[model samples]
Target chain A: MEHFIETIGRNMFAIFGVMALVGGLLMIASKSAIHSVLGFLFAMLNIAGCFLALEAEFLGVAQILVYAGGIVVLFLFVVMLVEVSKKKEGEVFQLQSRYAVAAVAVGAAMFLAVFRKAFFGVASPEALVLRPELAKGLDVAHQNAQAVSRGLFADYLLPFEILSVILLVALVGAVVLAKTERV
Target chain B: MVSLNAVLLISFLLFSIGIAGVLIRRNALIILMCVELMLNAANLNFIAFARHNGSVAGQAFALLVMGFAAAEVAVGLALVVALYRRRDTVQVDDINLLKG
Candidate 1:
């Protein structure tokens, strides 16, 4: 029974991972900007699936709320605002394709070779575990969101506060940049 | 539980796809989305590593990445729109004012 559950989980992870990659590909493959946004939306949703499968419950929900909902909708607004559909986009890919393809292909091959050895070797990476004595409260039984929130508001309070400031500056800058009239 | 190796593979592939998209695509918005894809891939790695290490720090960092990426997209799209307004082009090739 345990093995069956494990197999099912693995299969679901594969499904989510593969679908996410497909969506990412679709983002590049489609010429239409709106279509790319749609693909990105699909990718973000599947990535959220990947997050949930990994048991990062807080991240999974945040992924949906932030990436899938907020950022993607913002992309759609910009795509329409710019009126990409009004004009036919000639030459969807960059001019220097041959070099880019070669670079990406070589990089991908290197990565795969390294990952295969690292993952499948005698001492698997999964075996290396570090359950810190300090984080006793972060056990699996604890609710992930509560643990995460505690970590955020307690351990990472400074950075969390800074992130809010960054968000404020970014929003103001975006508005200033996009405004038609002089500031 | 999903295998750590499998999660790593997915993250790597997603990141590679994102790199390919950025290098291959000409549309500014598509490229921006690709950047987001790459960021998501990194988040996957952080979460998976967090799980493997039995800690929540990775999740916290992933949240930080999400927040930063959101801000990045807002600014990026704003720039895209601003460029569109100025020269009426979203293609990366056409907006080469810096080439001057």
Candidate 2:
């Protein structure tokens, strides 16, 4: 019964993972800008679910809070502010559809090459193995925001501080760029 | 348990889709969204590897990446808005004033 439940959980994770991928594709392939943004939201939510499946509960919640709550709203605001005229509505793609095909081919080739190397490069045909010690640690850290905060504050303190500065700079830059001067 | 390879494959596919979107899409906003998709794909890889290797560093880095992504979106959207104001359009092909 435990094994069955575990299998079910694993399958659910796979479904979420696939959903994330498909949502990304949808975002890219959609004709309307609003549709693309909606697709991005879907992708973001599913990615957060993926984080939860991996037992990174803090990251998952942060993804939801930061991405779904903050970023998506920001995107929607920008979309609403920017007027899409009738002329622009028809021009969904660029002039280089052929180039897009080439791009897709190149990307697919890269994925295949890397996938082949990662999976088949080693001579040993062993199944995926989880590190027991790390697994135990992660199991403890799972759904534990405190563990993530400890690591952020202790080990990655400098980066955390630097990120705050970056955010501030971005805020200032955005204001400067978007604000129109009234003459 | 789900295999790391499966997770990685999904990430790769998402990344490729983002690439395709970036290449094909003319709208700067959609392109920005595609870039976010790519970033999310990379983050998925980080979390997956962290889980497989049993380290918290990957998750930490992923968080940092998310922060950077948010900053990037802010600046990027601002630039887009400014461009639209100046050129009255957000199409990449239309913004060719810098093509000297």
Candidate 3:
């Protein structure tokens, strides 16, 4: 009975994981661009669920806000703003689809082989050695948001600030690129 | 508790699917979405590892990754818009300049 309960506990994350994969597949396989975006949205939400399952509460919320609220909206606006004439069904996908799928399969196999050889694989040790700065680790609070905030504000402040500048630059670059009239 | 292996497996599958999508799709926008799928897979790995290590750094890095993904999508979609303006098509195969 105890083992059964534990299995159920583990299955929750599995459900989210499966849904995420399905969503990603849907995003890729859809014919219409809007349909593809909708599929991507489904996948993003399920990924947030996966984050929450991993107990990364803050990260989960940020995923929804950034991807769902902001990124998807941007994609939708572009889909609407641009008057892209949908090509004929035969031309929707690139030529030689079967060959591309095969190549991707080979690529995925190589990817798996390389990563499995390098990283601490599934059978890795639980006690991973973190950086000395963050080795202090989460406190007794054990709060997901607290730990993440401490990491960002206390340890990663410089990168955090630099990221802001990057976002600003990207914002300016986007405006310049998408401007209607050229100077 | 989700095992580290399970999470890793999920991330791997998601990433493979993303790669296939990118190669198979001709729409620039959908290809961009496939790229987002790949990024999410990487982020999933980060959070899973963070949880496994009982540290906050993985989550922290995931947050940073999210920011980068946002900035990336902004620039990429802008490029898509620019492409549309010049040639009026979002199909990648049609985005060639060697034609007469």
Candidates 1 onward: DockQ, in order: 0.62, 0.57, 0.58
User: Which sections of candidate 3 miss by over 4 Å?
Assistant: A1-8, A83-89, A95-100, A110-141, B98-100
List chain A TM-scores, every candidate, in order.
0.82, 0.77, 0.75
Error of 3 at A119 (Å): 15
The 10-residue segment with the lowest total lDDT in model 1 chain A? A121-130
DockQ-superior candidate, 2 or 3: 3
**lDDT of all predictions:** 0.84, 0.81, 0.83
| Interface RMSD for each predicted structure | 3.0, 4.3, 3.5
Q: Native-vs-model 3 lDDT? A: 0.83
Look at candidate 2 and give me any clashing residue pairs. Answer: none
Best candidate (score: DockQ)? 1
Q: What TM-score against the true fold does each predicted structure earn?
A: 0.90, 0.86, 0.85
lDDT of 3 by residue, A61-176 (tens): 99999999999999999987763565544665664768877777787788788667656444333433344565465542346676577667888999899999999999999999
lDDT of 1 at A93: 77
Docking class of 1: medium
List, residue by residue over A21-71, the lDDT tens digit for candidate 1: 999888889878888899999999999999888778888999999987799
**For model 1, how does the per-residue alpha-carbon lDDT over B7-79 read when each residue is reduced to its tens digit?**
8899999999899888888888888989999999999999888877766688889999999999999999999
Candidate 3 docks at the CAPRI level of medium
